[model samples]
Target: MRSNGGPVIRADIYVRISQDLTGEEQGVARQEESCRQLAADLGMEVRHVWTDNDLSATKKNVVRPDFEAMLASKPEAIICWHTDRLIRVTKDLEKVIELGVNVHAVMAGHLDLSTPAGRAVARTVTAWATYEGEQKAERQKLANQQAAQQGRPYTAGIRPFGYGDDHMTLIADEAAAIVEGAQMILAGESLTAVARKWDEAKLQSPRSKVTGAKGWTLRGVKKVLTSPRYAGMSTYYGEVIGEAQWPPILDPEVHYSVLAILNSPERFSGGKRTGRTPGTLLAGIGGCGYDGCTDTVNGRGYRGVPVYGCKDTHTRTPRSIADDRASKATLARLMFPDFLGQILETQNAQEGQSGAQLQSQAKELRERLDGLAMAYAEGAISLSQMTAGSQAIQKKLETIESELVSTAGIPPLDPVKGVAGLIEGWPTLPLPTRRAWVDFCCIVTLNPAKGRHLTSMSVDDHITIEWRDVSD
Candidate 1:
């Protein structure tokens, strides 16, 4: 095959494409074919072919395994479809030049690495390629920002869980699951439990379809629950921008409540009782009523009998009796028309500082945060000042979000005649749901008996139930 050389030069073909949208590697395939033809025309024997499909060469941190291997092989020459495909930055160009081998680009002609003029040309071409990549990145960033501000659905990433491929049309089954999962989380079900339930139901996450992951992870389930997209909102850089064009899987109030609960500092900071599925009905909801004691009462065996006892051993009550009383009290409150009316009235009156207002305040605070960051970037403020200012704004945002969770109120009950069906089915309800109902209606506390041994004391004398006010 050699026309002018005594020994044919060995050449390796390298191909790369930034994005393979179809995941078909067609671009890299085409480039490899062109490179092979170029090698034939140059009278070089193609020894190896290296491809980095769907990988960007402009990013400094991205590692191209095949490219590295081609360089290490020390081929007499390298062939590529284009200079941009082979290298997009000066740093990569320098690495190629260090090999002291000729480069033959089908589109850009030959580059003799052994000559100073050829090295300069390679550097110049790489610099231009880097400039083009940066300009393209800036244009894409602007387009995404505009799309978010206009409340358009992002079509780039994998399809969201509750939506169809378009990310706008809702899939009824998936949407219903999302709603149910949100309610379960709000009713004190653990994230792990919800994830297990979904996995058991054969629900697949977005990644499962691509990676063949068999089941959902706790983190995946949490992301679905807290995503603003499910609430029909568009987000840019983690800040909600506007209402999305897609229909919402969850009501905004419920979405905000889930966000607040999951993001609560107390949930992460020593609040062990929150967001856990209780082993017993009154395990975490009941507290000790002894003077100067503020500890939760847990369900455990006392003398082989199930009882709710203080963590510090200050007081204990029969679990059966306490649970019965609390359930009865909650059902009674729900059954009373006047009590239900009072709750509705109180909720209505609090619309002045409702979820919408809190969202607005949150948006304002987020803007202030952006401004603070910009100021720091421009050297208008010191790091300490920026930190202090951001901290204060963040605290206010947390308080508003916490208030949003409280205003979400009790989960809706089944619409049955006279509300009797709910009371009848109360015994068959899940423990977490029942516990949430109890928490909504009253606070149960166990106190030491006035003058009797703890074991001999009647539950009625030792347990105190304080009904929550309608406003609370």
Candidate 2:
């Protein structure tokens, strides 16, 4: 608006809304409309409109692009729905004050940044807003902790894969897919294979459904298999707190088995080999049997057939023959009453705690750690006290995890299925389990067959099976 009949003041409207869950920008639209009306009431000429939709002003490290643009424009006047919408902290207040513009707010009235008293008033208002924001954040954090302790499902963010929008109700089709995926992983199917099957079946991921994207990644499939929520567990900050209110999509036994396989150091190597799924039985397990060569073999094509060859070309054998030899040797060992009895004895001895008991212990340890952290946060305990308590709990957790790894790697065999049943079901066992059985029972090595063609090599003449000491 004109001052003393002078040229009309050029004004810019800045509007922002911290959250717009519907993505409709309705909140910002209302802010802009009120700001425009404020500008008109002051008889100012509107030159530009700046909007930062669904963007927090008080959150740390948040950037408001349109707010930055409005400041750069340096309009003669600025109008907003409220001072809090324009500036939530003293630092931001200083920025607006330095712009040297006539600031007007529909709710907060005029702010004269040009005067020292006006600048002080702006800083005071922003300080209160900052305090309110921090208090709100603390309340929300406490609410989340209480919800986790009560076994309430987290209802924010994207809906989980096997659950409905509320996160408590199960989605039948998605739940079935999750159950099948967990079974497949335990049966030796690779994460990539399961993801491909899901994509082929047109089973969309939660993220895919929201974004209209259509496929699942290997990582996504692994996430579903590893999530404790499917086992009816509630977690806070990645630590299991209690049983969830929702029905489980998978049995706890199945869930823990999948977790054990996915988190195995031998399989993942600190996640360095996450995407590499061995297609052959002994590609990585079997070593080169030739003297002076200690390299592992890898699967490759040889004369239009798959073969496992040493990296140093020390020895090569048909993949089929090597796999068959390893399978037969492993099966034969499992059929031996004394050998099978020894394996069962060792497994039973090592399994100190049942899966359910271990799970309960782990949950208790996690809760203890969480309690320590909260105590430290609330100043109820000294930092040293919290650290010592946390470290002690962590050590116990490590011991439990080590035991879990040992027990999880045990062969997934049914005790009801005797030795004869194992032999009958040997061919149908998942490749992963078969490979694990081979590694557990014996070491298969492809020795060089002197003067013999690759096709002419026999398991008896070239393959060596060295049985491991089960008692050890």
| lDDT values for all models | 0.79, 0.79
**Model 1 over residues 23-109: C-alpha lDDT tens digits?**
778898999888999888778888999999878888868998898888888888899999888888888889999998899999989
Residue lDDT tens for model 2, 333-450:
8877688777656655555346557857877888899999999999999999999999988776755664455454555454336567768998886676677778878877888766
Model 1 worst lDDT run, 10 consecutive residues = 265-274
Give the least accurate 10-residue stretch of model 2, judged by summed lDDT.
Answer: 266-275
Task: TM-score each candidate.
Answer: 0.58, 0.58
In model 1, the runs with Cα more than 4 Å from the true position are 269-399, 402-472
Tell me the lDDT of model 2 at 365. 88
Off by over 4 Å in 2: 1-3, 208-214, 269-472
Q: How far off is residue 99 in model 1, in Å?
A: 1.0
Find the number of clashing residue pairs for candidate 2.
2
